[model samples]
Target chain A: MGKPKKEPKIKRKTYIDTWRFLFQIGAFIAILVNPFLNYYFHVKVIQGWYQSIAFGHLWFVSPLEGIEALLITKIIYMPWIIGMTLPIIVALLLGRVFCSWICPINFFYEIMDRVHKKISKRSYYKRKPLFTLPRWILWVALVGELMLAMIVGKPIFVFLSPPGLVGREIMMAVFFHTLALEGIIVLIVLTTYLISQRFFCQYLCPLGALLAFIGAKRRLIIVQDMNTCHQCGFCDRACPWGIYPSRGEAEGIYCTNCGSCVAVCPFNARKFVFVGFTPSSEKLKLEKVPSGRQ
Target chain B: MKKENTSPKDSDKRNGEISRREFLRVLVGFSLTLPELAHAKSKFFSSPVHTNALRPPGAVPEDLFAGKCVRCGRCAEVCPYHCIEMLDIRHGLYAGTPIIYVDKIPCYLCMECTKVCPTGTLKPIPQEETRMGLAVVDKYRCITWKGEGICRSCYNACPYKDKAIYLDRLRPVVNKDHCTGCGLCTAACPVTPKAINIEPIYSFKVSKR
Candidate 1:
């Protein structure tokens, strides 16, 4: 009788994971040093003196703001109009992988998680529904704010934005002013993140949620092979968002495409796969057989 | 053998059920309270200050005010003159927005803030296109107008080569039309109280007005 084939073992480390970590560290250092560089060196001189380039401008034009601004301003600048619509296009292509890999806030959240694990002596931390409730509430508020801006002529959400808060700190620091209030605000945000892995990305971030919805149906989804899964559930345990990869639907709305689960998986069952969009499939096929199998 | 094979399927079915329930709970919860939350949000929307009334001419569009602004401090970081300061009005929802007050630090209309706005919040306007507001001379505070002394600081400091503050036979008078409202004149006016001030012109119509 032929010997039964054993399930393959997956490597713990991957290139993407290494790159993600390096990017996170680099971004954090850059954010910390940004103020000093602006003040002393005048490295990237903006027209307005001493103003950090980050806060004064929008990274992208928000659709909600763009449509509302149209009614009042009457002058629809095309470039900004185009910039706001680009996120929807990008989301359709890549699924909010940006949130997991590139967001500076997510990098901070990961750091906070490590600290939380050390201080609380708990490896697994789950967020309460009460915390998640605010995300949806905020989204509703954003949409409502836009509608009101259209009817009543006002934009409300700009004030409470996290980016705006950070911008204020950078500006104050550049001017040699005390950033105590900004520091306190940052602490509150960091504390919330420490309690829950990706607390803002999963729950509070409207952009992340919007991208998730747009990309959910895309074929390129993270999947696991049930037959090969050792039920070690390391992938499940490693998931920052607490998703069970073995369950076969990596289509969970909260997935940030961070690849932590892929990094820690002992068996090479889990892999990113495209279902419909792309004709060819590329998977990280495992080479070594599982240890304890006949 | 049959029981072993069936157990995995049963477990899969159970997991599917749980997942469905979780998804439904999240969806329903979001749907039910969305309207109420939006209603509450509408109350906080402050009307846009009119463009003409805006003391400065380059009033950014309202849509540019949405929360997509990453606020990386790039604008403040790159400013050559160190004029812009990000304000944190943590009270009543205006907690983190960056507001430039001309009195403390006036914008030079250099277009640096607009250039760095990656998100189009600060739409880039060219230097020639940029208009903040008109500078109006407060005659009561002017040394020459008040007859305290013949201080021509405002006229000398006017960046507009033509000089918006002209001495009408050497009695300091402000030509409101030519005033670009750069605040150089305000900063230069030599008086105990100071004279020149740039007030926002109201362009958009207001309900109260």
Candidate 2:
């Protein structure tokens, strides 16, 4: 033998991206199935959709809806607070995973993103400069929506919310044998994928903005093993949200935990690591990695 | 190529730091538009009341219902009679909000809609306590009133038959206090344009009858 045989490295079997995709698909099917169960079978076991859902006696409202009710009604609604608990805790830990793993609108948006990527190869497709909007614009939009809701004294943004519309439209189609006029809003937002990936989630969604605000100091975040990373930039290309994980530009609020970067990393260097457990230098060294790569 | 890669991120950081001019500009624009937006919301987004259309039993007054309702579609999903339908986009701000088309399908007063309401917009109330609307019988349209024939359809169809509707000289008479306005009579009425109709008395959209 010319040299001792090298041992093959064992790859981790579970792909985070695959789990995320399954959850997204499951959420889409659940929206469709909830109404069907109610209409045909009269199963009152599970009711409602993303905006609010009730499981038998236990019920929960979306955090955005909860906050709107709180502000508009100006009363402490305990049930809404109770309903919002699980989502808030998840956001606090996982950093907008609902956007990637659960939102029905995002499920459709991901499909549109794939189509956009394929068609962009043609000369005619117009692509917006990636990540041009300042992240605070999301906060501004959110605050503006809250103010509008208070002014209108209604849950005004729910009318424009894509996820809300998708759920309500499906319920309308199944139970009432007609679709609502607001279904047009979902169509319009999906069409924007041709201009930019995740345009609605990034720039416009008040619900996403609220979740991002709650997840700003999220525990689980993408951290690179600087020693192993070769500055290959595969993560940058893979991240449809335009988050550059290889360059350590994984802004906590913007990263949806889609795991596209993790899936694309040839070196197996990028990972979801809790910032609390990681050393201060490893966490703070995000700034130094780009200079070294350059 | 690297410059292109790095520049947007750098510019993004610079932009994130709110400039004084930018702050002032946004403040001015928001304040100027606030009043106008509020006025338009009331003027244009007001819910319209339709005849034979009633909110599910236990619904709050119409004005508060819009603000409190999250449009969850739970009420429509749980109706055993399939009487509840959400208002479509044509209804403007009321779209996706639940309503009962009493003429087409009357609420059976299963009280399932009230139980599933996550918002207290539809307070959970018992069937006998339901104050959905008051059914009004059209004397001119009623067969007994016309002397065309003796009809007890409204009297027979009423859930609280003896209490809500009673036959007086073979003509159906409505007792407003007892009628839950479930609209079973309207659905059962064989006449065109219905011999009786449910009017949502609690809704601001409908003027006092």
Q: Which candidate wins on lDDT? A: 2
Please report the interface RMSD of model 1 to 1 decimal: 6.9
The 0-to-1 C-alpha lDDT of every candidate, in the order given, reads: 0.55, 0.79
Q: CA shift at A193, candidate 1, in angstroms?
A: 4.5
Question: Can you list each candidate's DockQ?
Answer: 0.16, 0.30
lDDT of 2 by residue, A120-232 (tens): 77522334554467767778889999998898787786566789889988898888788887799889988777656777788888999998889988888777776566676
Q: Where is the poorest 10-residue window by lDDT in model 1 chain B?
A: B47-56
What's the TM-score of every candidate structure? 0.70, 0.82
RMSD of 1: 14.1
- Runs in model 1 with CA error above 4 Å? A1-12, A45-75, A116-153, A180-185, A193-195, A274-279, A282-294, B1-57, B60-75, B90-99, B114-130, B202-209
Highest DockQ against the true fold, candidate? 2
User: For residues B104-197, what per-residue lDDT tens digits would candidate 2 score against the true structure?
Assistant: 8898988988877887778888898897788888989989999999888888888999899888888888898788988998988989989898
